[model samples]
Target: MLFVSTMFESHYIGRFAPSPSGELHFGSLIAALGSYLQARARRGIWRVRIEDIDPPREVPGAANAILRQLEHYGLHWDGDVLWQSQRHEAYREALAWLHEHNLSYYCTCTRARIQSVGGIYDGHCRRLHQHADNAAVRLRQQHPVVSFYDNLRGEIHADERLAREDFIIHRRDGLFAYNLAVVVDDHFQGITEIVRGADLIEPTVRQISLYQQFGWQTPDYVHLPLARNAQGDKLSKQNHAPALPEGDPRPVIIEALRFLHQPDIGAWQDLSVAELLRRAIDNWSLEHVAENPSFSNALR
Candidate 1:
């Protein structure tokens, strides 16, 4: 078992796990910057994890570009980066444990069938005990989590309707789902705190429940507001949010800091990355982050 030290638990360890579906955009930068500042303020370790397990949706050069973008923005991470694709064995081990405990079961339902019967996934496979020969796996949400606390947003809770739904852990195509992979990774990395965008708030409760099931300590969570577009839609790769400019990222970085409610240290148009980040770390504040799901489209 991955035991956390009392001292480390009291301190902080934040991460920004980004998918490699496209180059890092303004929204992605906001998340990274927020997580970076939080870690730096607490003198904690900041880590980056490449969620590249889904090869089918991953863009070829996006992963390298993301790393380059982080470097350009002066958001250096500690230790070697952890790639989810390279850790399939660990996921399998976790899955085997769940299977042995009878907490997971095979699911072979299709999307159309699911939609035809209300959108929630009913526990059709909970007692099937069908082997993994030709079935996906799902976590039986017997002890669903309805609420959890967020350090920034205060006591936030999940929709009980959503919480009780059994969710998929492994897909029909044999690929691991985000919920399962992320749980395993966080446990392995000993993440003490999670500082991510508010859009992910819905999944936090379920993840917490998973941690409880595995007898692991749940990390503190801070869900920062999401950056939206002019259309009031969240900026994302699917929404065609433009990638961060290729060279001289100072202007963009400074704007992102301001968006996070940090005071303008100085014009970063001419500053080196080291200078910019030093000022950022010194001025990071959780109070600066707004407690809402959306932010103005000022990054554009």
Candidate 2:
């Protein structure tokens, strides 16, 4: 379950962590290709992580299918893929440490209750001193990060109220929260930079806060523009975005390159997938990427 390699010893490490809720789609391809190029350009290790922590949302065989799609598009990874399902003990240990150090407390507040209080938790349980049965665990917000430096954007500030909230680390249903798992795994994998979609930009501060709590260094981040359909909805499984088709992936790769504003060396029609990828990696530039999400008719 643990992957150890000289790849971790590299100066830079980038990863594409996807939840296997559905088949790999165009939006995800854009993200994967962007991250892959960023890593390959710097001679850094690119890794893939299957975020299978949420079982209810996952399709049965989607993880293997995703790996196949990545390979089909020539987005080769550096090591064995990491599955969050195989890392429960690590989360348990982390939770234990937080609880023992009084850095986390239990909460029994339901969704409706939080919604009634303007949708932001007011640290109601932090004062009650009650560790109720089957309660969710929340980290105490001592050092809330209101802003973080993005590799592309100079300084992005987060909503002060949201940043100050004592966010959940584990759910009442016994599932580890995304922010906690991502921070822990990013550190575990020795990630130096995170290149993901712009939709996740809001959570960057929360993850950075976790790094501060753990006394660990935070990685650099670059959030790429989100691909949206005609109606302005982001291309995602919940919105029913179509999966990457089974065929020659050159054209789609070229489209993704254009989406990121990367230069095309030669005519893509005359190039193979491997060759196109080589050119893309050779010409990758983070400075060319857009700062905000975009609505594209091609994604429609």
Candidate 3:
């Protein structure tokens, strides 16, 4: 139960959190650009967070590469970059609070059993009083949120079974689960809005449920349309999507602007990256962005 008295919910505070799985690609650029413009358009604060918790998936020097890529595209963020790896103490303290309050329990449910039960976890272990030895921890879903509102798409809902399940907060492999860490970090960072890709929309309700459990404010969410390739697969590092070019960000920036359905101003070719960013920020509008997934030759 990590609670905060101060509310940043009144003002605009946005963040772009990227995992160090690999360098920034075209799809990731859309997220960064959209979040940056959304914050700057209101003269609000924009922050960056390095989500490097999953060491198995992280690449060497990928974090630095991401920062460099952002700089190359003139997507400057405000304040210090918060690293998830350094926040283990905070996560520990939160888990401790939940345990003390009887709001969480340990479970040793296997993946095969979960799949046998149709993949959504049941509360079978909630009343079993399972031991903590080599077990994962799950939060007691006191108030499951089935639906939430999106800034881009309205009135979003989650699967009923998923919303009602006792979701994991700590993994059996001795790492904090993403749902728990993300909610805790967002609260710690005082984020008032979350702007990311549409692929993440399904987790919004789970995150909101966690916020409710913590008695903290839930931030606004804006899930930008995903970028797809010619074959219709969403551009992703897993798909070995090509990384953004290091030289000359001008063309890609213009293409990204076009992908978002923003006005090009007919002089993007003559403007420097910084000036183009300035113009784009001034003209950025969430309403103007496309609702469908964007497909283009833009470096993803």
Expressed as tens digits, the lDDT of each residue in 101-190 for candidate 2 is 799999999999999999999999997887658799999999999888887766788888899999999999999999989988888888
lDDT of 1 by residue, 21-114 (tens): 9999999998999998898888998989999999999999999889988988788999899999998988888888887888888988788888
Worst 10 residues of 3 by lDDT: 291-300
| TM-score leader | 3
TM-score of each: 0.92, 0.94, 0.95
The TM-score, computed over Cα atoms with residue i paired to residue i, of candidate 2 is: 0.94
Better of 2 and 3 by lDDT: 3
Which residue pairs in candidate 1 collide?
A: none
Question: Which whole-number lDDT from 0 to 100 does residue 239 have in model 1?
Answer: 97
* Candidate 1 C-alpha error for residue 70, in Å: 0.7
What is candidate 3's CA lDDT for residue 69?
Answer: 96
How large is the C-alpha RMSD of every model relative to the true structure?
3.5, 3.8, 3.5
Comparing 2 with 3 on TM-score, the higher-scoring candidate is 3
Q: In candidate 2, how many Å is residue 98 off? A: 1.0
lDDT for model 2, on a 0 to 1 scale?
0.87
